[model samples]
Target chain A: MIEAAKTIPVVRGAFREYYFKQARAVEEPGKIEQREFGYAQFGQAGMTRHLSFNSIKELHAMLVKEVPSDVYCSNAYYKFPTQPMQEKQWLGADLIFDIDGKDLDLPCVPSHTYPVCTNCGHALPPSDEKKEYSCPSCNGKKAERVSIPCSKCIEGSKKEVRRLIEFLTTDLGMQRDNIYVYFSGNNGFHIHIGDSEYVPLDPQARSDIVGYLSGTGLLAESVGVRKGREGNMSFIKFPRGGIAYGWRGRIADKLKIDGSSIIKLKHIVDQKGGYAGFKSELDKMTREMGVRIDPQVTTDVHRIFRMPGTLNSKSGLAKTRCADLESFNPFNDACLLGGNKVNVRVKTHVKLKLKGEAFNISKESAELPAFAAVYLICKGLAEAM
Target chain B: MPVQLMTSNLSSIRMGTGDLAKYPFLNEAGEYLRESGFGWEELDRPDMKDIIDRAAERIEVGVGGNIYDKLEKYEIEILTFIVSLIMVKSIGMEPVLKKYALSEARRAEEFLTQDLKQQSEMQKHSLFAKIFEDLFKLKIEVAEDGRLFKVRVADYLARSSHFHEQEWKLINRLVQGGHVYLDADETVRLVRNELSVLIYEKVKAMTLPTLPQAIKVKAEELRAKLAPRYEYRTSAVTEYPPCVKHAIEVMSKGENLPHSARVMLATYMLAVGKPVDEIVMMFQNAPDFNEKITRYQVEHLAGMKGSRTKYSVPSCEKLRNENLCFATEECNGIINPVQFGRKRK
Candidate 1:
């Protein structure tokens, strides 16, 4: 008979931080110190502290007295009595590119400044009064001047400003005058809602928003691809069940289709330029082949933190300034903060070979290429250019 | 025919321990016996061997008697036909045996005539049916002026009608075991496996919806209550800021720590094994550490120091520690010790 090996106890490092900061109050005469422990309950970070003892000896002694003979040491940790409140205020949003558009630059202040377009590098004038400036290069017709930093050229920066304006006034139900939309000094836009009521949402509620948009919540079950015209088709094909790839290939063969054909369809979906372009081609294919396709495109909102930039802290407002002039890449630098935004850029590309023939396609293909493009985009493996 | 009848009788005889040791041709022994409730001392008399030998010979001759042999042969033929019917039914065939008329009526009449002839022959010799009856517990009687034959046992118990169903199932399981005769241990294992399968089938076939629904509802409620409790922090001192001070305080009490605190203190003691004074000093010197030292605290913490005391500790930490202890010993415990000493070759 084989006897199982004895388990050894594992020790983990534990530490926590308590924040103590004094903030000035307008109504009160003096500043008040706000001290709170950073630890939250239920998370690995929060629970670690509860298990820590002054010394390892104490922990071992406890183990000897209370633990059952069969249970292993590494399985136990610090258990807290109460559930931790989730931290909410930190919400994430995405700015997706629905259609390929020109690269735009937004204004950034120095120290917090980001790169601006070399073609129309202009800063918003510093003043309490709101004013608009037109881009001289765009002949004032194409570009509207706004009092915000433009990291891209001044002409292109107008689009981001317009988008922020529309989002604040319409999507978020915020008054245009009260909302402060700023150039994140990169590719995307950031809107700060100063409403105190929206500051601290419980972590679960914050997670719910993330879960909802990510299609991971209870509501996600009902949210499925709508049945469109009978002839419409989706290029991407998902597996029916947990069958292996080899089994799937066999099944596909039995269905009178080869793996290559399915792959080619996926390629076409991902290469399609836009959702409309993908649908039209899919409809055409369905009409000709008598097969229906239901295309589904899902967006995932990933949470991110705002990194340090060139904006000057003393200004207390967003300004047009240049920072990091030496090295700038919008793809790497621009990070979207929390909240709702649409039309994010996703790149999807694939190589298809059929009948001793190989073709490389981008998102611009109209037929099978477009379906593959959309498929890639939907799976998040690639993005539309 | 007589030789075949004798051979059949000899084959059917099941040997007893005493009779088995007596015959030079043990396999040809005609008389058989199961374990009787008789002690060895009762057979110690000088005449016991002769009596037993004579009994065995008489049994052999009686079973070989022409009438007994004829009836046994006919019984075997009928039993073979019955078994074939059962086998065909088992193979998904519709059974028509119940509707068929008796096909061997002439053979049955011949069997009756042979039994009467053999009875007369035995009566002529000083041997009688009484001797055979007493030995085999089987009765032989002629009925309807010797036109029909009947055999019966006064004390023999016939198996229940459902016996075949159970026996067939057991036979199938035993076949899966790859053996004809199952030892007691193997039989027990087979029995347990069959029981488990039976229970699962019974449970699955239950039509009552409320039973499963109630179980599921209770499980969900328990999960909701336990989910929060299951969520645990790693090491208290390192993971949570508030827990550091609490940990220090618990450790300062040493053996005198509270039930919960004792678990924490014992964990610390096992890790560093610091003296009471040293433990007190470490807590005092540490920033934000707020534990007061007491002799009772040291005693409380000490209770969880050894192997035996570890089990009494309630904290998960203690449980895990015990597991580690057992693991370090190569999992050798009172319940499951390493067997066969097949060390890593």
Candidate 2:
């Protein structure tokens, strides 16, 4: 096993090189003085937070000096950013949404990611269902989870990002230019709505926005479906002017049929078995159409989000913004570290491509570029030579 | 003036004294009192006896689940509401203040429902639109048919967070162009909670003044009726499930307990053999506490009322469904909260 004492210097050195040369390139958040910054050093137990900076130069200096494993900035704007939580006097907060590939429950995740026992290195069969962390073979409580940066996970996450943007723009009526999209550096995306009407929304208001996105607690009766009073019979009913707004209209579009007349829709429902059968079809449609997001992240006004353009220690990639989402690729674009060669021991069958170069390494040990080596080391698959 | 001209002028104007009298908490009513040069000292005058008496009845009937009958005189109606706020403040009781606010809000909600249904097309600012905008800063529009009111989705979400009903969910309602559509009754219902909160803040902020003999007597009488009858007993039983403990903690802080949490707490307390009156006493600190309502509900749960069937404490599954369960490691592997700590016992 690679000791923390040995791996700490190797990873820390690689991070220091990036921060020293490219720390100034970190994107400066709006009203930097009002943001609360946080950092975690190499091998640190917890983050040091409640820190604020006055300017970009100060933030860049701190980054270069600390060379932290991770950097975060608050989504909330506070009167006293450095003060304790209750005293921070929150003025407002940017509405941020996180779409993680892991939460999507994609079929490809089980193949690309598997659970390995941290204690004995025993790999277990991966399933898309919730996994119990305990090792069946050794009964160890820890599991080393490895999620390879595959094209499927990325494309799956991007599709959700697109769906979210469509909801934000078309459904929520938010300006497209104000919505900022970023690669979360590992297996996800982050959307930030800054300097917009949504920035001033409180957590409860944000939770409502989350509810609109997730479509939780939807009642079928409220959306143009009701009972016909034949004791157990059900039928579809539309308003006098017909269903033309929100989920009702969205469901109507999903039916893929012409003529939304009451008779035609009712006949269609009857053809699909009955009210229960039609309800299942609509429910399935919502399950596909609902924008999946991490509710906790959006609801938390005080959360210190990973700053854009900063190094993400999870995969040795930058938290880079996607100006053109269709063409932005994380493996190619977010690989910010230099290509200097470094010797490392390969602990497993690792295959990854970085900066247009693919490395299919199954050897005991090999010499690899610093970015690839850092990625493997951060993932706990290899140690420094 | 000609009939057509008068009608056209009426459509573009603000609410009159009659409208303000119905919604006395409206800013215009306050302005009317100010412009009329009515002073707080006038409250102590013998001439204002009718206003003071009606104010006491407002509280008496308001706490009893109904407000007083409408007064014929518009000035007296506005004065009665103002005097009620003064009386509630002078009594210096939190529960009484909350109850008065709720009663007033409910009264306004009834009027608002009727007004929305009757509002004409030419009326530029309906009471519903004005109240939503002024109180919540919510941008709102009404359908031409007057059957529906549209509010921005953000505004709806902010106000509807406390609503636990499935029908109030955003997905259940018609949403178009970032706005949610509500029927007249639903729209009025949405304002009820916030209106109560706004009234409570207004009442709580008013300072008590030296009152005349009649008003002082009314305050003392109302205080005696509303005050707690027993000393609070902090339940020291740690064996209770985490859900019960959490519910008690929230109630003791004078926070509004969700309906399901109240059921969970009451039934769990009943199951543990606590007396109905004692369980009723525990709910006294709830923001909207009413002794008559709480006692009747508790007794009903204990099977001492009409149905004569006691309610069992809800299972862990039910509480989880209601989002009321706050399970911990000590909760063990029990399916129902009643089974928690049973093995150790």
Candidate 3:
């Protein structure tokens, strides 16, 4: 049973050193110990909840102790009367934003999705996940299987993050002093807005902010864009008011329709007219422009998030902060361990790019550097020898 | 709406400051700005960062009213709401803000009804902004007698379409004499979604002032004082279920706990073997309490004197639906207070 454990790649000495570094925890543990924390170790049972830390030392001690597969901490700071959380008072919580590439509706990247055999469970290479999305092992017995992401897919996610940051600063009055952005170590990014001004906002208040971003329940007619009251209004002329500076104005300008001409221009707005259906057109437009957000993560004050500076098990990448968001590259930046090599027994064919180098491996044993091999091993493409 | 003329000796109208007097936040620092060629004329200049820094430093020490004193009532409202947000969130000013907000909500109701001539969109938003500004930031209590009372202000505010549907219910209470006190976390709770949220934050940030420690402390102390005061008999309270404890606490504060809260309280007391007279006696703090009517109601619920069909204590579902459930961890899987106490055993 011990010998039958899954195979993974690691450089000659890097995997052990990475394990040691994590065990020792070179940096101060529980950097966000002031915030509430919960964890889930690799268990045969399932993910656990309500695991908290008293201080950074305790959290670091847990890291060395449990070596959890996933670690999470709440965005909130609470004064717990007891560990039971019954008598605890909600002091405040940080505003958080999460944009995921896996959740994005973008077309298939070159190496993002993977096709797996429904019968034999064999997954094809990411390159052939689309178009020829048939299992090579089972000989065309399965459909395409969606995987996490490729580097280019994450780049698309990064662009969304930049756009969101800009919207938050200009429209929501978020100060740069309080905003902290981190890669989720998988296929997305997590942004924490620790602005003092926002801590007091409630779930409903946060919901309103999220609504604006997602355009879930946006009220374009209620905005000052229309000249008169609803049912009796005139179109807003170009170079709109301060209120229409965001998408409400942009969408209107793009469609070249004003309130007065809205019904007359129904052909452009809603070609598939089904009596009183222009509103559907508006919904489509908002959906196109709106940024998809994980609402539960942001509004929940007690929500625990992935601990930064730890390993993201899915990708074998460190969840580190981006010093410069624009120049940040997670594939390279997430590699925290030093240059060390480990021999890996190849169990399956896999192609991966890491630290500015690309490698293609066949179904044969091979030795590679630490970062690249670790990526394959973590991805379960090889076994460490 | 009138173009009121500025005739004060310190009237810096011609200083090209663009309606600074109307705002009412002008002071020595403002005068210094005027003297140093740094009014609205120098507002958006890239070189004014140093001047802004000096101004910020002076304000940090708390001596200048230049920026705060001359703000128009409306401008002050937006600024106050922003500052009040900090106080409630960081400093625990829920009670203080609730008190401030209750009075302000009353004032806002009155303010909203007043037919001011030529109310522009800006003026309307300003009116709302000022109400909220005062609601969250200020700590004003002119008298103990007038500090709190009962009113159906939630119902009143709900009648008007101007306010958020959730607000009046959360904040206002039915005070006696057909008045209500707007005192709840709703002001602090509702600000993030309020109309001012739509305002350009960069523009709104200019009006915000750093809240001093004194204000926060005062709010915290008042909030501590206002913690749900319950005059329950100590011996009786120990055996009361979480729902009963919660209902009595709200009632003791002269609040009209929901109709279901009252029903649940009565039923629980009846089940606990408390006499109808004592149960009716418990309701005296409610502003709507009337002896004969309360006794009749309690007796009807007891099933001893009225309809003869004894009403069972509401299940957790009913209590939760009435928004009166305050279940502790031990209360889990227990439906009635009698069961809750037995489970503890």
Restricting to chain A, the TM-score for each candidate equals: 0.24, 0.90, 0.78
- TM for candidate 2 is 0.78
Question: Residue by residue across A203-238, what tens digits does model 2's lDDT show?
Answer: 656666676676554555755567667733777666
Decreasing DockQ order of the candidates: 2, 3, 1
Per candidate, native contacts kept equal 0.00, 0.57, 0.00
Tens digits of lDDT, candidate 1, A289-333: 211110010011222212112111111111221233224333222
**CA shift at A185, candidate 3, in angstroms?**
0.7
In CAPRI terms, model 3 is classed as incorrect
What order do candidates take by lDDT, descending? 2, 3, 1
lDDT at A278, model 1? 56
Top-scoring candidate (lDDT): 2
Chain A, model 1: TM: 0.24
- Per-residue error for A31 in candidate 1, Å, reads 11
Clashes per candidate (backbone, < 3 Å): 127, 0, 33
Grade the docking of candidate 2.
acceptable
Point out where model 3 deviates above 4 Å.
A1-16, A19-34, A43-45, A85-88, A115-122, A127-148, A223-243, A256-275, B1-110, B113-131, B138-345
Question: How far is each candidate from the true structure, as Cα RMSD in Å?
Answer: 33.1, 10.8, 20.3
